[model samples]
Target chain A: MRDDVPLAATAAGGTRGDEECCTLATGPLDAADAQRLSEAFKALSDPTRLRLLAHVADQGCASVCACDLTELMGISQPTVSHHMKKLVEAGLVTREQRGRWAHYSVVPAAFAELRAFLDLR
Target chain B: MRDDVPLAATAAGGTRGDEECCTLATGPLDAADAQRLSEAFKALSDPTRLRLLAHVADQGCASVCACDLTELMGISQPTVSHHMKKLVEAGLVTREQRGRWAHYSVVPAAFAELRAFLDLR
Candidate 1:
């Protein structure tokens, strides 16, 4: 996953304000970058969604069945589907539909992008 | 700042499920840690808050005056105050009042803790 990603470009979305939002690299998170990142974090703001992320990451980012996620969360199937949609929209997790079920996993580059700005030694 | 922090203790509140919420170290983000992290990220979930963080950080963790933030954001003083209050509650930023105005700075360890979990390459 790391090999496929050009780290700099991933964080800085070229013409977008990605270059500016570097918490450590440049200045403050630029407007464009802030807009993008805020959406990602906003999706993560909910407790249920965080739990879903935890479950997926726990399975080693393996494609966890959406049905199992609904069971673990004890939320309605529609509610789980809603949370998954948000995560997918945020680009934090990927969804793969196997027949009637959807599988979820973390997007490493997305997590890495968030982690990098906070990495000031 | 880091030396004072017992990283384990910080991440895992003894009574809380901090140990269980390990996105990398353990299986899932336990309920307690998820609650905590979700709040922190929730504080960051807004564009205005993200901008405030960026502005404060751009100053090299130096204390930023509330007045300056108000002007920079082009928002009402009350709105800026509200956002800063949320950041403080989330433990992402520190608030220091010098006379009538408040000064803000980043909480390094807080950011570090968030980074650690996402450190899995």
Candidate 2:
């Protein structure tokens, strides 16, 4: 998603402070924000990706290497890497390089934001 | 989306009690469960659907009628009805017919399940 468009613009223009009050309700969502959020959810639409996220969360503070993921997912190394990259881009997981292996961990804030987005009456 | 296949199957089958501990990380997800969950996310992938959910939620405990949704969404009556049917099928919203009008409200439990599904870390 492009970062050029600001989220505050699409919000009902009353006052700058009032933007927070005009949530997903009140009116139509900003096209850019909706597209961005949809992309995140699309990335999560896959079961493999969901499993990967769960793996990282279950590890607590520890991270899982690419090699570890390959066996766990029953997928090829490149496939695992691709999924990891998608997760990283979606901000659902963070990757750190440790020598030759890439270690991945869950990003709690990203998940929290997604949860907040899903909140309904 | 079929409810027949149990979630406990693909989980590492050490014991029935161990199923609860498996979570999404321990092993590959059951194909049926993944498909069902994917369909739910697919139903929610649309911006219009998200807006509908948000509107119902913003109304607090009150429900919105089909006529109200058509005005708010600027969509045709049939289109709104179709979206409402899909939302009801996904369990994201519940519908109650008030005479000729159908009043729809958010199903908090369904949204909660979705939020829980998105829990990464």
Q: Supply the DockQ value of model 2.
A: 0.13
Q: Write the per-residue lDDT of candidate 2 for residues A61-109, one digit (tens) a residue.
A: 5566777777666788898899889989978777887677687766666
By lDDT, who's the top model here? 1
lDDT of each residue in A1-121, candidate 1, tens digit only: 1234322322212332323332454456778988888898898888778888877766543456777777777788788889999999999888877677777766767887877666543
- In model 1, the Cα lDDT at residue B19 comes to 32
Tell me model 2's lDDT, rounded to 2 decimals.
Answer: 0.63
TM-score result, candidate 1: 0.76
TM-score for chain A, prediction 1: 0.75
Error of 1 at A33 (Å): 0.8
Q: Native contacts retained by model 2, as a fraction? A: 0.21
Share of reference contacts found in each model:
0.45, 0.21
Residue-wise C-alpha lDDT for candidate 1, range B12-89, written one tens digit per residue = 123323332324544577788888888988988888888888777665435677777877778887998999999999
lDDT at residue B12 of model 1 (Cα atoms)? 16
Please state the error at residue A34 of candidate 1 in Å: 0.9
